[model samples]
Target chain A: MKAVERVDQFYLLKQLPKATALLCKEGNLLDASCSWLEIFGLPPINKKQKTQIFSLLPEVEDLIEKLQEAKSFNLRHEISLNNETRHLKSYFAPWFDEKENVIGTIVQTDDITSEVEKEEELNWLKNIMETKMEVSKTGWWEYEIDTEKLTWCKETKRIHQVPDCYEPTVIEAIEFYKSGYSQNKVSMLFHKAITDYQSYDTKVMIVTFNGEERWVRITGKPFIKEGKVAKIFGTIKDIHNQVIAEHRVKEHQQLLTTLVDSLPLNVYVKDLESRKVLVNKGECSYLHKKPEELIGKTDFDLYDREIAQISREEDIQVMKHLTPIIGKETVSCLNGKTTHFLTSKIPYFDLEGKVCGVIGMGLDITSMKKKQEELCDLIKITSMQNQKLISFAHIVSHNLRSHSANFSMLLGFLNSEKDQEERKRIIKMLTQASDNLLETLGNLNQVLDINTQESETKKTLNLKKSITGVLHNLSAFLENNDTQIINNVADDMVVKCVPTYLDSIILNLVSNAVKYKSPGRPPIITINAIKSDKGVLLSISDNGLGMDLDRYGDKIFGMYKTFHNREDAKGFGLYLIKNQIEAMGGSITVQSEVDKGTTFNVYFNEES
Target chain B: MCILMKKVSCIFIVDDDPITVFGIKKMLKSVADCKDIQIFQNGKEAYDALIERQNLGKPIPEVIFLDINMPIMDGWDFLDEMIELNITEHVVINMITSSIDPLDYKKWADFKDRCPYILNFKNKPIFKIEPNDLGCITAAS
Candidate 1:
């Protein structure tokens, strides 16, 4: 039996290569495989005396009893040798005789250290990948075009609110996209990627399995194999929070743009370099350009040199002073219309409290300015009319008072006189007083006539003919005074005036020249009319007893203002002539000296 | 009546109106026992006559009635010229006016400051002389 067992052991050892070992019933080391010796760093066994296995490996001594009792036993053990630990699996089986009684044991050992280390490293890698995917809400996807199979990572499944083990078909995956543009767009992109090997990177809206809306960003890449499109892979990121925040920011910006455009006033922003950075609708229209054209341009590019210089200087001042400047700016448009603006320029500052540019706003005030000027002109005319009315009141008071006084004096004389000759003289004096009273009334009536007459009575008349007619009417008085009248006026010179006023004006001026003649020298009157841009300038000059103008310049055209001591100085002729000339839209001015001469220049409007 | 008893040596009436001059002369003749009376048509004529009298070594009038508002030089101008004449005689002047203009009174007050010889500023139509008017003139002279 022992010989047959030895032969069986030797055959089993030879067949099992380096992993098998044999032991006797006494627990002694018999034969070891080549692999076992190599793993434990042991020397080859010799055939001198049988070796106990305990002495070879002391750690396996406890297992020897179990190995002796059981039919077959297996054990995993760690042994330390040469400062290194090694793991080994040992199996012991009893060798059987023909009578079924155990003779010896067969032992086998395997070096399993590398296999355990590999399994631990694989577990650590799997744990790290799952944690990364959970924190970032990022996942990967793959689509096999041939099989129409789709695969999604754990994070991707979470994003879609699906079970972890769920496998989606290509069509089912695309259905997760919201039904409108997102679904169509994703489907089209999937097909295009597979057929054309195209890559896509875009944001898309998706509806999850639970019917919750979410925003996601997908980046796709196509793979081609054997000259045919095979697979599509990409990353689908859950970017709901980022996309919503960005959308809200865009909405706020659009609202601000609309508010600025709605303002009627011109609003603009300019950079430090005087380049326009932003402009509203009003500003764009004011510049006669679109907003796109105006932005990035300057005042120098949009306006004339003079206007641009004014705007640039104001902007620079506001920025430099870091304060607002408000003022009026007049701009003349290309159509020759002028507009006035009340413009304000304020300095704009950056986050660091530095003046970066200027912000400008302008309000149009052209109509208001025009109305103010018209009001001023109206006030002037009303005041002038009030002065004339006051003067008229004074004339009525003085002239009427003087005439009544004369009548009373004459009546007193007639009542007291007793002598026949004195009585006759007093009667004559009364008659003369009545005549003078009647004459004064006639003169007052004529003044009233001129005052009430409308300007519609004015007509163009020959200036020379008017003067000649007056000279003819006063020829007798002129000859008696030895007055020489020179009418140097052109025969065809016309003046816009009322015919009656023209006749009266000429008569009064000529009569005055003759009446106020100097006692020392005969009067020489010169009448001349010269054509000017405004109208005809008719000047009547006289070498007579001219009064001092300094003392009577303001009073020369006042009623009852007499400068000279003359018998018939009624002080009404020049006053009436001034009123007539002014009524015809003309003006009269007088220059005089104490005894040298006097010149009266009358200016008439060309159209009137 | 008092003027009828007191005799004025020489009286001058200066006025532009011939009727007024004649009436004043007649009233004076009836009131006083005086023959030396002179009349001037205006202030300019009166001034010339006074100057001529001074040059001829004649007696200047003691009482002169001057009318304001005349054709030539008025009463104010006559008074301005009278200051330059350097008249040494004591003469009483009666200024007269036809109208009741307050401006004429204001002018008289200014002239009276320079020429204190003016004794009275009387209104026109002196139909009858009051005894007080003659008494004041005689007292001032």
Candidate 2:
């Protein structure tokens, strides 16, 4: 039997796999594979050599005593020889003789250096990934649908403020979401991702283990195996601050919209191209359209071409200059009615401080404008009354003082005169002066009556009819004087004045024209009138003897001052007519040249 | 009585009111030494006669009684013309008038500063004037 076993051992040792060895109980080598010798960098075995395996490979010598119990050992160990290190794996088992007594060890060895090095590299990568997740406040989660297991990463547990020993079920994970909308929405998305093999990303609110509320962004992606979803996993991020900022921005936009819509004045915003971008309720109502319809429309689209053209040019100027145009008054005539507005426009800027558009506001001021016009008219009337009062005072003092002084002087002369004839002469003079004074007083009284009376009761009358009536009354006299009357006043021309005053004004002007007839030609009187901005301008021109205006300009309207030598020149006609015209809110102006004709322009305030 | 009457070369009275002019003329008769006394109904008439006399190389008026209010031209206008013609330096002007306004005296006060020809101002109705009152019109005291 020994012979047979020896042969088996020789064959087995020769044909053993690589790095195999056999050892006696004392760790002496009985046999070794050629690969084993090569692995330890040993020379080939000789027939005279007696070697133990522990002497060849001392790294596993400590396993010799452990094999005395006849137990098997599998180990990983380190070996160094000739300054070269290697990782080694060894399996040891005791062999038994025929009588069942243990003798030596048969050990198998493997060099597993590459696998251990690869495992260390993988651990380094996992460490870096966990660190990154913690810093970003990000964590991952996985739900195994089959086992109903929920696994959370360490950072995920930190986010929930839970202990590391805490492990949650699928239902418990769903409960972490806030009770109402967040829970329902996350649950629905989770189920959908499971059954439909879909992916989802959403923001939801959660109640943590500590009862603190937070906003988080959850993304889910399903992992399908064999066409069935096994697990769903995604990232969860703490987005509380970003989400709160977004909500505040939305609220601010809504507040501005409400504020703009509440104002009664027209407010609108326009883009760089002058297209309306936003409009308030007031602006929409002004255009008689809804806000949606008014937006993107320009001034040219809403107003008359002439009116809008001006406004567009102004807007362009404002944008180009990057300055504001405020409180511009404008007038619009539409549907036979006039409207006034006070408008303002300002340049609006972008985030970069570049002028982007214009914001405009306007207020209706038509009624205010009407009130201002009425105020102006009132002021005119008051000033005119004050001027009349001053003139009356001067006239009264001047006429009375001169006449009284003359009377006193004449009486003084009479008292000193001894000759009866001289006395008689002085008395005659006194009587004549008294008559002159009485007539002067009567004329002054007439002027005083016209001045003191309130604005006369005015009636609208046709200028052509009034002029024709005056010409008719003086027709016979005009014919005797060889005069020709030219009435050019239009039939549509109308003026507001007291009726008798109108008749008297025409009569006085026409008679004066005939009275001052040039000796070289027959008198030619022409009357014309046209509507003017100031009022109705009536021009009565005459081809008659004209006085030197420069010499008599100041006295042309003075009482009791006559320029011409005519015997009938009373010098009261112009002054009386002036007072009458002023009482009715009218004015008269004359243009004349010596030896030429004359023209009188009478402006009468138009009737409202 | 021994004091000799101050004599003027020629005197001009400008007034629109004839009664006042008549009274002034009668009073001037006391100045026997005066060469001539001219009368005009208005300022323009007086100014025109002055120009005519200047052209004729006749004696210019040594004194003139100017009235404030008148037709055609007024005392102020005549004074401006005299200043414009550079002839005011040769005449003594008395702004004689019937105006009783205090404002009129204020105006004369302002004019008196610039116009040396305005020697005196008197009110109207000089019927009881003493002969000594004619001294203001004399060319020599």
Candidate 3:
């Protein structure tokens, strides 16, 4: 090459990104391209001049020895030239005349710093991603609309658990997702973004290289260029844990909501700043409004001023204590009525341990309190019964013992009298006293006998059988009273009762009917049974001498209280019958009038 | 006492009340011939006497007037004790009490299987007897 043309070629080479140089056998520069100067960032050099290349570029001395050992040799190596080592490729051969031999070594020095730096940055990013176990990286890939190029970021390969060395075609990458729904959805998303230039966000599962199924969220955005789709890009995120956590949170929230709604108690919560009310279903009715209506509204808007003020004060107290408070409060409604609530207010805390609002749960205790009062009344009645029984025992002992003592004393006097006539008269008086004593003893024994029958051993009995037994036993009495009996008792009706007590009850009622027949008409007795939800109702009605119900209905069951004066009528029979029936968990009621018939309804609890 | 033992066999009277026992014992003197007339206040004491005598190989009483109304142990309790020991069934047992309850009669009537040993239900005193006076023997087998 001639020297004049060499300068022009060297100038043109300086603008190239690659460096160039030429060296003679002595390691001096016979000629060097401008790229060499520019690579070292030095000034331009003169043409056709032998220069000391080592002095200018001290790092080139090691490269010269390597080049001399082999002819037509090429090598890539690094050297420290400007405080930083840069890689260079060199070619070496022997000089020849008109033959293919290297006259001097032609070394191409490339700065390659940018390329190496980019590779190092990529490796650093790879190591950071590989070590990150908590924040998993996901990726997506795309291709240009009209180009044969495919592009994927490192995160994209990682999301599919593919190695960095894996190079995939566009179609192959699309096939990595599950083949059915996922493949269809991804295909649709790609087609729509490419054709319509639309943006899409979707979630899908993909089978990774490691054979693990993973859920990823993809957000795709397309760019349009010249009315034609240019490129599409998207981001994929592992969102698996977040998705699972969100789903579990949703289920728990629904369960808690259902539990709160199903509870009989009223539950409500309010936001302090917004003054919005949130309530369970039961609490909605208590407010006389729907839950939606109550939402975004304060208690003052829906309730009376007193109620709102009291509720707000209660909420403030709850917030101050940061605990629950339980008590009773009267909530006045706009309807002009106040309801008593067994109320509990609690402060709800946010994640930062700050009180967000107050929650209140209440139970309406109006009916329960009424029932408690009734139970107290029953207790009082039981106490009165106990007192009455004690008094009865005392009366029996006093009256019977006194009469017996008088009879014994009279008999002793009769025995002491020596005069025959006076003894006879005294004996007669003693006999009369003894008879009175015996009568008193009988009455007392009858009363005490109830104590024995008080224990009602229950058994399942057919109503018809029991009534039939009573009728058969009272056949003679019914005939004597000339009474006609009509029985409409349900034959299959079964009741749980003490058999003996049931017999006695039936007999007493039937006999009463027969004895108290109306004077003008034959005594017609009706015995009917009805099955009700309460239990079996037994009604015994008689067209006999009925007393004025208004006057004696209240006292008919009282002890020693008799309305009829039949010779065999003992006032105590009906009284004992009523007590016996009541003690067996049954009740008795009588309806009668002065000239009309009497009907006694016996209600006994049915056995399940 | 030897002549009295010769004149009558032993008769045991069991009752709770002292007056009733005394009256029954006094009235029994006129009704039957008896040598040994023993009296016990309650069924427990009477049972003990019978057991003690039987253990000594002495014959138990041929006739026993058992009072149904006694505290701690009554005539039924005595009978139960006797039956458990397999006492002689030929010996007559009469339940004597002043209780005139129809339920008591019903209970006694229903117990006919154990009644051959029980001769009758008798009222107290045993003083008066008439041909049709079922009063002395309320029920008899």
Candidate 4:
């Protein structure tokens, strides 16, 4: 060894392996260990030259004050080496001479670059985890079974509104769960976790340290060591806002359900397929079904087929147009009894305002409809009575006045005549006129009695039975007249009418047929029934004698008007029958031709 | 039958009512004509007789007292037949009616507009007519 190297520490530092250096106050390198020289890209010690330390580490100049500190200090700074960024931490202690005067810094650096980078990455991950816990309103808590200690994270402390320095015990932590169900439940679960190593997840309400109530999700897991629970750690999430919103939604749903269920009318919600999705009490009762039985059923299942078809079509129309059908009167029948409903339906919209179904309400109006029908029948009967009175007045003036006029004319001739024989002849003509008046009065009386018979309840009579009975009575007369009778009335054909009036009507028509049998041919009278909207139409057609209907059509049903000149043609028969039919709310019409045939089409009240 | 002295050579008393027809026949013979008074029960028989007379070249009644209300055919129907057959060149129809019905008056008015052989539209009972009234009656056109 050189004699100077034995006393010089710088020369002795030359052989050190770690990066150690001696630097002056101006941040210039004085002596550096070989490892330091090698790491900083310097030459070996034997051929070393003074190198500028600040050139490679210009940022190190800011740490020069750290190098001069009396005790010891460390500094970290960045350097670029071989196009790679690296961090270095250097420790500096004051260098002293024998006289105790500071000269420069003895700097020892370690490539702590990897250590600083690892520490920086760890700090970044820790920051991210804390921020995530804060954002999610989640916090952790741990319980040590043996120590009976509970420790809370910063987020958990914040959730409980506890002071930062507060320490918690297991009993105090469980007390945070609001008393009763929440507190009791958590206590049981905590006991179970400690004893049986069970895991638990539950939602509970808690009272914070600040005396505010809150909802939270509590979860726990037990860690076992050697068949014994070491600790139980879990998350407690602040779920206050979410739980409150859910509570509001549940309340609203309950309110709507209660309101719809209480309505007396038939309220229903139908889906796009017109199936009953919801029905109120009234609808269930009207259909005679329970809610469970009625839900998911269609109108066709509850109503008659024809009525169901109409209801479904209306539902479709409402949904398609997105328009409401308000207060339309509809009819329903059950067990042969009819009911009326004032129904309204509106399109049921989804959240998007699209018509997804129909909501309908039906109000019972059967009694109101019945009253309206009664009013209509009253009006009809009043009009019919008025018609009867008018006809009565006209017949009295026309027929009776003519009779009185003849009496006056004959009485005047009897007084003016000079011969007794002519006077006697006038007296006999006067007697005949009086007899005609009496007969006219009797006919009018019978016509007036039609009102009484009409007031009686009508009965359903089979047309075939009535026709057969009449034909049996007329069999002898028909045989004498050589009349061919064709009774074509169906056996099931029925009409509602007064019995005696029907008998008289049949007798009058049949007698007229036989009385007016054709001189050239035997009479052919056909009686048939056909269904009509008004009722069963009985057609009594004859081939005996047909008058010129075109000329005398207006007077065919007139009092004392005859279409045939037969001696027995009373002319009052058709008029009487017409009055009877009109009083009973039926009608009669005739079609005839000269010398062809006459057909009397009579309509009776429909059987109820 | 025809008579030279009777004002109407053959007068027809067509009525459904016997009393009315008897009174008219007696009055026509006593006040209007002396003989050849023809009687019919209704307008249908009256119309048939007129058609028969026209077909057989017999003398048609000079004056037909036709009643408005009759069976099978009425006075209006008889007049319709008369107008259709064109046989009223020399005959006159006196429409007799007891109808106070306005419809009858309207119908008579309608026939008056259509026919030239309407002599008169009279009320019931020709017993009130005098011989001078019958002489004054004549066809309007």
Q: After superposition, how far is residue A256 of candidate 1 from its true place, in Å?
A: 7.0
lDDT of 3: 0.71
Per-residue accuracy of model 2 over A377-449 as CA lDDT, tens digit each: 8897788677767766777777788778778888988888898997987888788779879988999888877
lDDT for each residue of candidate 3 in A1-608, tens digit (9 for 90 to 100): 56567666655555555567666667666555666766556566654465665665555557556656646666555666678777555555455447755566655666666777788999998777555532556565666767746677777788888889888776887787788998899889888988788899998888888988777788788877888878887778777778788889999999999999998988888776427567898888877788788888887887878778888887888888887888665545658766667888888888998999888788888677668889998897688678658656654654454445445545655555577986776666666667766776786675566555565577889999999988998888788878788999878988888787788889888888887788899999899998889888999998878887664566677554455544555556677678766666678999887668899999997642
Q: Tell me each candidate's TM-score.
A: 0.62, 0.64, 0.41, 0.64
Model 3 chain A weakest 10-residue run by lDDT: A398-407
For model 2, the stretches where C-alpha displacement exceeds 4 angstroms are A1-238, A254-393, A407-455, A475-480, A531-535, A566-570, B1-13, B22-39, B47-64, B79-92, B99-119, B124-133, B136-141
Candidate 4 local lDDT, A474-564, one digit each (tens): 8898898888888888889888888877888898888887787778999898998898776778889998668777778888898888877
**Cα lDDT tens digits for candidate 2, B11-98:** 8888776667776775566553676888886777888998898889888887787888776677877877776656634577778777
DockQ-better candidate, 1 vs 3: 1
Model 1: lDDT to the true structure:
0.79
Which of the two candidates, 2 or 3, achieves a greater lDDT against the reference? 2
The model with the greater DockQ, 1 or 2, is 2
TM-score (chain B) for model 1?
0.86
Native-to-model Cα distance after best TM-score fit, residue B33 in candidate 2, in Å: 9.5
Interface RMSD of 2: 2.1
Model 1 TM-score on a 0 to 1 scale: 0.62
Model 1 stretches astray by more than 4 angstroms: A1-312, A328-343, A360-367, A409-428, A468-492, A517-524, A562-569, B1-141
Clashing residue pairs found in predicted model 1:
none
